[model samples]
Target: LNSPESIAVVVAKPIYWLSVALKPIVSFLGISTEFLLKLLGVTVKEEAPVTESEINKMLTEGVAMGAYEEEEPILVENIFHLADMNAGDIMTPRTQLKWIDLNGTEDEIMEVLKNANHYRIPVGTDSLDELKGLVTVS
Candidate 1:
């Protein structure tokens, strides 16, 4: 257990468990740092690393960390290639959708907007089977 692999396994266990248990809480609070710490059974300690002395103290104490340096940037050939991934692979889909009949009168369209709080509404011919252009009510 003293090897690098063992150390990685030990260190990764808590982080993985923390991420799994905190996912719902993180989603509930919209991924805010303050919320994340609370969800992770930790406290948010704020210490400014503004001054040279403060920065040096942070580095020495391992309080603040530096970003990882990568030799090459990540490249994506087709974003749809990511479709093989499931919901957990990406952020939550928070889309607000409203459907309207394209042949409907202006008043009908306005009525839909008045009832629902949305900026854009997708126009459909008959049912949602046929989709037309989008309408902006704002």
Candidate 2:
């Protein structure tokens, strides 16, 4: 109280006295420091950061505990694979692409549609390389 150096005394004295006063009760009840602080109306701020492994562990445990069905992992894997997939990866090769001649008659077009089993067909002039545009049959 006499100098700035008494700040520690100012702070520590109350804590020391409070601890001394609470020791008998805490020891009698065998309460933890955190629980004691909570019982004293003091909120303890804490953080538990979750990692990838922890999430995986929790998911695996959930699967084992029947919280999730067996197909749940498949969905997670498909989600992961989605990021790696590109447009070309899932498209059919050029060799297997179905096309329709621009000069084809209505019967020819219907035949192509019947054989190709597709609602839309790519229109071309003489070959697939001379691509004109898409033809959608509604």
Candidate 3:
């Protein structure tokens, strides 16, 4: 029990247990620092953050002035909206998927990759019903 591994575990034990113990209390609070300070009878003022439209307007001006060489302005806009999106919300239909078989040989895989445009391809064992997983080609 006095070994290096055991010593490391003992040192980390408090951190793990403390998180487990505090998780519930932390979840219950679910308040800002200002809220906690107010509970303790301290004065705190919180400011509202800048709106998304304001930031987008600034970026639009930057693009209009030719500050960015490429189409970074459009990219920033897409990223801003992408933050509020989920993969499932934008997933292609199963009928329109470009997939490959799991049991395909190297030659078959090479052929598929040669003609394919994407890096990640859905893999299936038998049919699309038995889809194993996705394969990412480097």
Candidate 4:
């Protein structure tokens, strides 16, 4: 193992490994520095939108750094989850809904409002299936 070729191989192994480990970081710095230099003193540059995964990552880091409460990330993540869901996932089914009937008596509408416990009650012609509009009870 003392031969010239053997010594070269031994030294090359560590150098090769070091280059492989640093390649990504070096490439990223090279590209990012170039981009920053181009954007120096520039304003209103169009940027890529922050993605849901990126938001989650940021929230996790913020929580770890004590910048955000533990519950904040859960709330933000739930909002993202909601964006992935259909209306049916959160909507109350017709059978369980309390709606206002246009032809119903005023007292009946008031009764529905009192029992509904919701700010906006659906308005329908005869039943929940025929939704005409919404009655907002403030």
Candidate 5:
């Protein structure tokens, strides 16, 4: 009977060889598993498993460095799973967004700008659900 280490090596060798052989085919098909894994915060480096804090730090650093903008947006056809994203991920969420009311007077708009400390505010009728336009403080 083969030793456990010998059997494991035999099993791993074929998988490694298969991956190398399939690399070109995968590239041709635009299937970048490595890229996806990287996006999911997986490190190929020979280090211990990443902690939540480490992942958060990496994500913040990536965002600050504009790493995502550097890469081409992933196409739908090339994706295996539905991408996990939120409205806040792509744009400002309603809660964080500052806006002015359509019925608000110029004085009222000025008051909002003074209080809110924002450069731009959306003008809406009744509520933000009915966006009229944008007001810039300049």
Candidate 6:
């Protein structure tokens, strides 16, 4: 009775009998054995983690299959693309940038900064080409 096979038989016999006994009730209720096990807080299987490439492929396929909204896949794809982007790729062009003039009055600088709605603004001498330093607007 202490042997491994004996122990297995001892442990498996009750489970086999239980399944046999529950089969008819399960059939009557039209529910799967796995579903019943889940209701009993039993996990049947565990899913492995997906890689980034797999996730990107799944998102592409899901969008093509119309399983996801256009915006949803686009957002996920953008996140994937973000890893490949450098600062130059995401930075604002110098022509469109806002800066605080170093020679401007404090009130004028504050007004310009307020209108720009920027947290860290670049401070320059006369133009952007003449770099002074960075100013943190609180």
- Compare the candidates by TM-score and give the number of the best one: 4
The Cα local distance difference test for each model comes to 0.66, 0.80, 0.79, 0.89, 0.72, 0.84
| Weakest 10 consecutive residues of candidate 3 by summed lDDT | 27-36
List the candidate 1 regions with Cα displacement exceeding 4 Å. Answer: 1-97
| All models, RMSD in angstroms | 17.7, 21.3, 8.5, 23.4, 19.3, 20.1
Determine the backbone clash count of candidate 1: 0
lDDT of 3: 0.79
Per-residue lDDT of model 3, residues 1-138, tens digit only: 459988887779898999999998887776666578878998756888988898778878877888764577678779888999998777877887777877778788678777776778888875678888888877
Positional deviation of residue 132's Cα in model 6 after best superposition, in angstroms: 1.4
Q: Which numbered prediction scores highest in lDDT against the true structure?
A: 4
lDDT of 1 by residue, 1-138 (tens): 459988897789899999999999978777676677788999767886576455445444442234322311122213334756887555433343566887889898778888866676778997766987777886
User: Residue-wise lDDT of candidate 4 within 1-138, one digit each (tens)?
Assistant: 459998897799899999999999999998888788778954456899999889999999999999999999999988888989999988887788888999999999889988886789999998777899998887
**lDDT (Cα, tens digit) per residue for candidate 5, span 19-99:** 999999989666577778778998777878976557556656776788744233333212322345655555777787778
Whole-model lDDT, candidate 1? 0.66
- Work out the TM-score per prediction: 0.30, 0.36, 0.41, 0.43, 0.32, 0.38
Judged by lDDT relative to the true structure, which candidate is superior, 2 or 4? 4
| Residue pairs with backbone atoms closer than 3 Å in model 2 (clashes) | none
In candidate 5, how many clashes are counted?
0
Residue clash pairs of candidate 4: none
| Model 6 stretches with alpha carbons more than 4 Å out | 1-79, 84-89
Please tell me which model should have the higher lDDT, number 2 or number 6.
Answer: 6
What lDDT score is found at residue 43 in candidate 3? 74
